[model samples]
Target chain A: EPEVTQTPSHQVTQMGQEVILRCVPISNHLYFYWYRQILGQKVEFLVSFYNNEISEKSEIFDDQFSVERPDGSNFTLKIRSTKLEDSAMYFCNSASDGETQYFGPGTRLLVL
Target chain B: SQQGEEDPQALSIQEGENATMNCSYKTSINNLQWYRQNSGRGLVHLILIRSNEREKHSGRLRVTLDTSKKSSSLLITASRAADTASYFCATDLRRGGADGLTFGKGTHLIIQP
Candidate 1:
C-alpha cells in the first residue's frame, strides 16, 4: 500500500533557529495536513493544505509557522524561529477524499 | 474543541480475550475513525464509521457509532499479545472542506500473554 513519507526522521535544532520538515504525500491524494503531539499527549491539528493554499490552521500555527506545497508531491512546514516548547512529534497526513487520512511515521523535532 | 474523549484510559486483558474501548464526542461529526499506535510510533488506521452508519467491521476489529448519543465503541475480539497498543478515536467534523480530524487522548491497551 502507498503511504505518506517524511524526511529527516529526527531533527535537533537550537532555539531561535529555523527548521523545515518535509513530507511527500501519496501521489494521488488531494488533501494534506500537519499535526503535532507533545510527549504523552493527544495529537493536535496544526494546519491543513489543499490546492496550494492553507485551508485552516490552529492557534499553535502562528506567525512563526508556515506550510508550502512547492511541488506536486513535496509538502513542507517551516518554523521561522524555534522555541523550546516547539519540541514534539510532527506528523504529515494525506487523503484522496476528505475522510480517512493516512499518517506518516512522523518527524521528531527537538529544540534545545 | 472538536476533540473526543475516550473512556477507561487504559485496559489490560489476557491473550485470547476481548477488549472494548469507548469514545464520546461533544459535537456533530461527519465520521469517526479509530487508529492504533505502538509505543513511540505513528498512528495506523484501523476502521472508520460514518455518521449515518451504526456499525462497521474489518478483520477482528468491530466499530460502532451512535451519532444520537455522540458516542462510539471499538471492540477487538479474540485479541493476541500483539494487540497491545494505544487506541484513539478521531472525529471528522462537517466544516466545508478545511477540516482535519480531532483526536482523543487514546486508550492504552495491554494484552498479556
Candidate 2:
C-alpha cells in the first residue's frame, strides 16, 4: 500500500479568501479523489480525477472549486473563494484500480 | 441524490461483544463498502459486498448487502478497544458512471475495555 501524506495538516483562512490544499507522496495511483466532511455531517464527495482530468464532481464543487494534478504527481484542490460553510476536514485519496481508495490523514480547514 | 443513512448514530459495547451497524440507502447500487475512521483521522476501507453477492468478510469484519431492501450491515466480532471509531457505509450507485461514492452519516462506535 502507498502512503498518502497531506501537507499543512491544518489550514485556517479568512472567509472570501482563496486557499489551496494539496495531496502528495503519490506513487502510481490512477484515480484521485477529494471529499469533505463538515463537523457533524456526512463525508461528501467533491470530485474525482482520472487520466489527468476531472472525471466527476458533485454539486458542491461549484465554479469556485477546481482540481489539478499539476506536475504530474501533486494533486491539489483550490477554492477560489472560501466560505464559513467550507470549513471542514478535507481528505485526499488515491486508488490504483479505482475501487479501493486509500485516504490521507486529512487537512482540517477552518474559515473564519 | 442517493444517500446512505446509518442507524443508531452511536453505539457502545464491551470489548468482547459483537458490534453491528446497519445502513439504509435510497437507490440502487453496484456495491456497498464499509470504512472506519479514527477520531480526527482519515478513513480506512474495511470491506465491500456487491449487490449480487450477499456477504463478504475480511479479518474480523463482516459485511452484508441486501439489494431488495437497499440496506447493508457491518458486524465486527470480538471487538477491542482499538475498534473504537466511526464506521461508515458507502454505496457505489449504479446510476452514476462516475466512481464517486455516496456515504452515510457514520455510526460512532465505542468499545469499552
Candidate 3:
C-alpha cells in the first residue's frame, strides 16, 4: 500500500535556528495535516492544508510556523526560531477524501 | 477540548487473551478512528467507525461506537505479544469535510507471554 513518507527522521537544532520538516503525502490525497506529540502527551493538531492554502490551525501554530506544498509532491513544515518546548515528534498525514488519514513515520524534532 | 479521552490508562494481559479499551468524547463527532503506536514510532490506523454505524470488525479487532453516549470501544481478541502498544482513539469533528483529528491520551497495552 502507498504510505506517507517523511525526511530527516530526526532533527536537532539550536533554539534560535530555523528548521524544516518535509513530508511526501500519499500521492492522490487532497488533504494534508501536521500534528505533534510531546513525549508522553497526546497528539495535538498543528495545521491542515487543502487547495494550496491553510484550512485551519491551532494556537500552537503561531507565527513561528508555516507549511507549504512547494511542489506537487512535497509537503513541508518550517519553524523559525525554535524553542526548547518545541521539541516533539511531528507527524504528517493525508487523506484522499478528508477521512481516514494515513500518517508518516514522523520526524523527531529536538530544539536545543 | 474536543479531544477523546481513553479509559484505563494501562492494561496488562497474558498472550492469547482479549483486551478492551474505551474512549469518551465531549462533543458530537462525525467518525471515530482507532490507531496504534509503538513507542517512538508513528501511528498506525486500525479501524474507523462512523457515527451512523454502531459496530465494525477487522481481523482480530472490533470497534463499537455509541453516538448517543459519545463513547467508543476497541476490542482485540486473542491478542499476541505483537499487539503490545499504545492505542489511541481520535475524533473527527467535521460533519462533512475532512478535518484534523483530536487524539486521546491513549492506553498502553502490554501483552505478556
Candidate 3's DockQ is 0.80
Which is better, 1 or 2, measured by lDDT?
1
> Clashes in candidate 3: how many?
0
How far residue B44's Cα lies from its native spot in candidate 3, in Å, is 0.4
lDDT of 2 at A14: 100
Tens digit of per-residue lDDT, candidate 2, span B34-108 = 999999899998887878899888989888888888889999999999999999999887533448988999999
On DockQ, the candidate that comes out on top is 3
Ranking by TM-score: 3, 1, 2
Q: Which is better, 1 or 2, measured by TM-score?
A: 1
Whose lDDT is greatest here?
Answer: 3
Q: Please give, for residues A1-112, the per-residue lDDT of candidate 1 as tens digits.
A: 8999998999999999999999999999999999999999999999999888998898899999999999888999999999999999999999888688899999999999
Standalone chain B TM-score for every prediction: 0.95, 0.93, 0.96
Model 3 chain A weakest lDDT span, ten residues long:
A94-103
Best-to-worst DockQ order:
3, 1, 2
Fraction of true contacts kept, per model? 0.73, 0.67, 0.69
lDDT of 3 by residue, B1-113 (tens): 34699988999999999999999999988899999999999999999999999999999999999988899999999999999999999999986565689999999999999
